[model samples]
Target: MHRLQPLANGLRTDHPVPGIPFVDDSHIPIDDPAAIEAVICREGGASMGRWERMNEAQGAWLAYTADPLRPELAWAVRHHPEHGRTVLLLLTKDAPLWHSSWRGPKLLFRQGGYWWDGTTWYRPDQAWDATCKHFSLRPVPDATTITAADILDENARTDGGRLLDVYRFDPEAKPPDSWNEHLAMWASQRAADARPLSQCVVRLSAPELPADQLIGVPKMPNIGDIVAPTLRTYIARIQRELPAGDG
Candidate 1:
């Protein structure tokens, strides 16, 4: 059984208080604007009834993952456009998070930057904030659009390592995911080749937003009532491996 752990600073986000309707504090502040935009866009705007419903479903699952008692081995946030809703997929080790090492175990698909504006799924650069009460639109790329090269350069400036090395990409490749795939494949190859595994950082494009906005809203849900007991145990095992500190 997976064991559950308390949410660390890195994973905690602001959320509404339960059983409260239309309270002022219900609208929690997200520290990182870009991150908030990612979450909001992923949620398809707060005004959408579908988004609210999806949030309710996913929020319950997250609460389960956050439980200190009940735990999950791996949980996925599944988006279903047909129903205009999202669901959580809880799996045991029989189904690992990802077959590949480079990818995270779970997937949350929504608007992102890589595609043209208005398309589902966006790359981080494509996400933007518009002046709206509880919603925003994806911005079209313009002269000011942050390019992959620009992202690489910024990382190089901030960190001593070259972005190319960090991201493991070829400059000539179009549609950067090809490079991302190459890096992933190479890691898999190395693992198979019996080479000592070395830590390699990968540079990813992310949206620009405030700290609170990036971190999400905070709230605690009753997970014990929702998820299976064995899954809860699995989460606890993983939580024990995490670094101990404030985060």
Candidate 2:
């Protein structure tokens, strides 16, 4: 039996929902977006006249790669009619997804930039305050505790080398066997909770909002600041690995 391994940060490894068959390498969704893109691009090269092909080739060279075979992989493909594009998404199984709920009439945490609602990331600024309430997920309604995991799935993977703090749920109890099913049910709720972007608000985050609201805002360190503590720890590790004098 496959068991979840605990990480140092307290999040458990994302384990697949029991009994879901692992997709074999030979059956890696040939009709998927990546394969389709490759086929279309290759055919376009063959069909076009030499001179015309050169111009088209520039745009057609968009490349995509598949993830290595893993039993834990779960994915979804989405098509955006407005953008005329297909998006491939990977998701984790039995992971503690973030979601928000209303608590009375007030919108809580206005300063929070991004709120994860287990399904998709939501920008609260796009929402009308009166229409929403506090941002909280009822992971297991009525349950005293819940389990949380590091969401390293495709749609919600992290690259900062820093895993988020483990959000503890009821760790003692086993989740419902149909946990994935529960996630699907939550999807529609999240959609209903979402507010369309205002006509005047083309940008998701604005200066009127908190500083953290602005994605990609660089941290401006004080003049007195030194190297980050994490970097110092890495230096110590390197010294230990090197010859005494060389370090």
Candidate 3:
């Protein structure tokens, strides 16, 4: 039997239904009779069912990655009052093309919110918007290769060269306590350079595969299935640091 874990911060009510162990404000509550019945009538089950179905559809893709790029996914997990969890899923047409044959697809996911109540996710209205602003994405011209250095170089050559900034990806792992420090450094440098940290534009290092030769359209996985373990880990870490309550 699965055990329902306690929420670190008192953000969610701890209510458990068999099969679905982690029930809290992060999910649409099942206790409301009207909402429950509505869900059942329309979708046959509640949020868990919906999650499962979504997971199945998303999991079919050959390459799928998810991050809190969109407000919906973040809102789902953060349970922010003003802003909903927004998520973005990227599905690759084929294996990521890397400049170095030794380098493979390296996907990284990050979670963010305005307030961390030591356990649960929270955000003031202003804070929520500010956070959302940082999580925006922009399109770039399709190319065969892209690197942080290349972006900086492009900006240097452009008319708005002064507006450019340099961003670097950390390859080494660090302790949890150092995360904020690293982020602060990165943010400070970017700010000093006057560039907004935005979505990464991926470039292919090889020719595109013909559509006829490709398999089914790649799909992205739902947040629940793709990062449930990470979510649970975050929940546990918050519980350890904050007051005990259902999250």
Top TM-score prediction, candidate number: 2
Query: TM-score of the candidate numbered 2?
Result: 0.21
TM-scores for candidates 1 onward, in order: 0.19, 0.21, 0.16
Candidates arranged by TM-score, highest first: 2, 1, 3
Model 2: per-residue lDDT, tens digit, 17-101? Answer: 2211112222323224455233222234531101101112222211122222322322222222121111111222311110012
Off by over 4 Å in 1: 1-74, 81-132, 142-247
Which pairs of residues collide in candidate 2?
A: 98-117, 98-118, 99-117, 145-170, 146-169, 146-170, 147-169
Judged by whole-model lDDT over C-alpha atoms, candidate 2 comes out at: 0.22
**How many collisions between residues are there in candidate 1?**
43
- Worst lDDT 10-window in candidate 2: 1-10
Sequence-dependent TM-score of model 3: 0.16
> RMSD to the native, candidate 1?
19.9
Model 3, residue 67: C-alpha shift (Å): 12
lDDT of 1 by residue, 33-59 (tens): 232223322144431011111232332
Q: lDDT per residue, candidate 3, 1-247, as tens digits?
A: 0011211111121111011111112233322323322332214432311121122222211111111122111111211122111111111111121111101111211111112221222221122236656322221123132223333432232221111111111111111232223223223333232323332211122233232442210110132233333333433445322111111
Tell me how far the alpha carbon of residue 136 in candidate 2 is from the true structure, in angstroms, after superposition: 15
Candidate 1 residue 220 Cα shift, in angstroms, is: 30
